[model samples]
Target: MQFRPTLWPTLITIPALVVLVMFGWWQVQRLQWKTELIQELEIRGAGPAIPLLVDARISAEDLMFRRVTVTGHYMHEAEMHLLNRVRDGIPGINVFTPLVRANGGGALLVNRGWVPIDWPGTSIEDHDVEPVIVEVTGVVRIPDPPGWLTPGNEPEKNAWYFIDLAGMSAAAGVLPFTDYYVFATGEKNLAGEPVPWLAPDPNEWRVDLPNNHLTYAITWFSLAGVLFIIYVIYHTRRRGPDDG
Candidate 1:
């Protein structure tokens, strides 16, 4: 008496398995696209900074990744450190300071840059630079709400996981500002090359994070394989001599 393979379970699952495989392949394609885009932006987008004048024509925060300059006073008294941010694999916090426009229209949140973890300064009063009218060139970046898996921001403790524009504006008490932030450029690595610093790169296929579509594709395909194996083994055992 022996058991054998049947068609019923395969019939039920083949369609589903095919769909999963297709999804996995789609993710792989997306990985290639994302890799190319990230490289392109980092290469071609790197350029000299644009100095934004007091009467500069702003897009009400519509622009992104475009290099621009904002010359103003650093309101260090209202600054806040973006908690748990990192740079070039170094543990540090992003310095968020409100750059009050010299012409007096309003202010914009400026990510001054990252300082070493050992650098002193936990409060807004611990400014590394003197308060003076200055010009800064940076890339425009839009604020994003914290991801679902990300922990919520703690405004009371002055710890932030993401840039909540409204919350920052209210907390800092500077207003009429645009709904965008600027990440100052001219930050060089030890090799003396410009780094994007805090650019809004959506789909970087980082090896450490590994959230690319290829990884997703592999997962779905692997699941399909497991499902097929299970269906075969279970149906084989279910078939008896009489059924055969």
Candidate 2:
């Protein structure tokens, strides 16, 4: 007929406290990261495209949709057709080619853009445009494999889209290229492939991490209040009338 504070509350309350604290901490970290990203974008978003090999390094995580300049040759044999890609609302393959940099010691994988899947079951002939080096300007982007979910990159099947930089480098025999790739920004190359490079427009960037821990904290504190009220009412009702 009476409620007691015992091991059950300890077990449940302790774990809940731990989880609430950890969740709040994680949200704080996310809020901080989002703030820093916004500030950085404000300062650097207006700059011209950066060279892939520039002294100022940019990580793929941060550079997606950012404009960048790169120079390299198309490794046509290594062109991979990423399944289920689309352009202008048509299903297609996303073509990825290795760019042997003009700087002469490294290569960078470049996304040539999407092409219709009408060429299904047929391998497109490889063509060399120019042995001479040329520059490409485009936005930096993360790999978007064709499927909403893709199996792993299969070099043997020649299927790919998600840029697993390490895996791609190894499979393409690029033995030591940088760990990221760029989307070529322009008309198709001389080989008649489409080259669509997008810039980091404001409409393209999204920053949507909110801190609701304060609200959550209030909810939790309210629970604590309800528990206290229930405890007080139960003891008052159970106490003998004359007991002091």
- Candidates' TM-scores? 0.66, 0.62
| Sequence-dependent TM-score of model 2 | 0.62
lDDT of 1 by residue, 118-232 (tens): 6655455455455465666777776666788887778788887888888888888867457678777633233333322332321221212234676787898899899888876
True-structure RMSD for candidate 1? 7.4
Q: Which pairs of residues collide in candidate 2?
A: 185-197
Ten-residue segment with the worst summed lDDT in candidate 2?
Answer: 196-205
lDDT, model 2: 0.60
Alpha-carbon local distance difference test for all models: 0.67, 0.60
What is the TM-score of candidate 1?
A: 0.66
Candidate 2 lDDT, 112-182, residue by residue in tens: 66666775422535353334345777666555444576666677888775667777778888775565567
Superposed by TM-score, candidate 2 places the C-alpha of residue 137 at a distance from the truth, in angstroms, of 0.8
